[model samples]
Target: MRAISMQEFGGPEVLRIADVPIPQPRGAHHLLNVSRAGVNYADVHVRGNTYLAPVTLPYIPGNEVVGTTPDGQRFVGLTPGGGYAEQALVHRRVAWPVPDDISDDQAVALALQGQSAWHLLFTAAGLRAGERVVIPAAAGGVGSLAVQLAKRAGATVIALASTEQKRHVARDLGADAVVDSTADDLTDRIREAARGPVQVALEMTGGKVLQATLAALAPRGRLVVYGYASGEAATVVTHALMEKSLTVSGFWLPHLYGDRGALPTSMEELFQAVRDGDLKPIVGKIYPLGEASVAHSRLAARDHIGKLALDVTR
Candidate 1:
């Protein structure tokens, strides 16, 4: 099997191509002949050892795959890792059969990033209709989906993106308003866009961005912290949160994967949304499996939009 493996923790340079034996499924896992592998910020963190969970050396760094089993059942679902390979293993219970109308690459886009967007908005944030929500990195994979999903849920979405192009993308995805993410007046912009304090916020990048988003939230508003893509964790002031009556929570999809009911439910709704033409996935570049390093470089640079994927067949 051709796969990308990293032996050290550092930059994108650490990911290198290697010929390793195909992974075999055990227990509830099913082996898939990987067609495409979803690339995510989490993969970058794993490669650099900065993820919430630690990674061992000589690890394969992809957690989402879309492919077919030996039995010819096409599946698009979460893998425990090893997705940047010609063959990988996915838990049968967590994996779902691909819709006949969807492509492998498109299915790969929805598997992880799509689910992340779904859970981040509804499950973690407990989003409700008529609420005003701020989604940081609104042009990225999960953010883009969040924007569309939020709008579909009848929420007013204030999107923040770093560039004009990304801001335009967010607006096209049905955000009520879009702001320059790099603006020094981010908090002011968010509040103004929503016409006042926001009811909810999806925080991905930390550090200064976290402070700005927190400042934009209304009393009793909830904030979901999912990722620190900026490589800086937030230093929250407990007093400020207490005074504002704000709540902070964290969301990791794997935790819900254990909730058999949650996984199938989320996956079904996510797929149905796409099938009904109510949700559209944003897919960026698709790199060859051997060029996994290149994909990481693009993701780390934050110069790309939507989800990146590895075409294992290449």
Candidate 2:
């Protein structure tokens, strides 16, 4: 098997294509012949050894993939080992068989981002119907799904994207309103779009964006912090939250990976949504497996929208 192996934690340059023994599945795990590997911001953090979980040296970085079995069954899943390879080991509990109508790219998009978006809103934030929700980074993989899912939950979605094109994508996904995070009046814009202070804010990028979104939350509102894509930490004051009785919670997908059985329901719901024409997975770009470093660079650069995937067979 061919994989992009990391011998040390550093930057994209550290990922190198190397030949390795094919992974063997045990117990509930299934061997996946990977077609597409989803590259995420977590992979970038993994390369830098800054992820929430510790990664051993000389490991592969990808967390999710869409692939087939020797029996020709197509599946999408989070790989227990690594997905930046021609093949990977997917725990059967986390693996969902791909529908005949869903392409590998679409299935791969649903693996991590789909699961993350679902958990962020329903599990972490406890989103309620008729609430006003704000989604930061609304054009990226998770954000795209977050926009659609938030709307489906009967929430008025105020999607924040960095560019107009991304904002357009958000609107097409059913966002009630879209705000450009880079706009000078982002806070006011979001509040105006929501028609009031938002009831739920899905904060991803840290720094100014998080601070602004926090300020835009309604009284007794909930803010679910998922990632710090801005590479800067956002400081929160306890007094500020206490004044408004606001709640802030952090969500990391790895925390739920231990409960393997917890994933199928959400995966099924996500797939069903896609199948029902209620959700669309935006696949921005596909790179060859050997260009894994390039894929990482593009993701880190924030040059692409939606999910960027690596075609292992290419």
Candidate with maximal lDDT: 2
lDDT (tens digit, per residue) of candidate 2 on 1-314 = 89999999898999999998888677888788999999999999999988888889889878999888999999898864589999898887788899999989889888999999999999999999999999988889999999988888888999998888988988888989999898777789989998889899999889988899999999999999999988899889999999999999999886788785668878888988898888899988899999999999999998689899999999
Count clashing pairs, candidate 2: 0
lDDT of 2 at 211: 91
- Which portions of model 2 miss their true places by more than 4 Å? none
Which residue pairs collide, candidate 1? none
List model 1 lDDT by residue over 1-314, tens digit each: 88888889998898999988877568888888989999999998898787877778789989999988898999987976788888888888889999898878668878888888889989989999999999988889899988988988999999999999999999888989998988999899999989999999999899999999999999999999999888787888999999999999988988887787987888888888888777888878988888899998999899999889999999
How large is the C-alpha RMSD of every model relative to the true structure? 1.0, 1.3
Candidate 1 backbone clash number: 0
For each predicted model, how many residue pairs clash, with residues at least 3 apart or on different chains?
Answer: 0, 0
lDDT of each: 0.89, 0.90
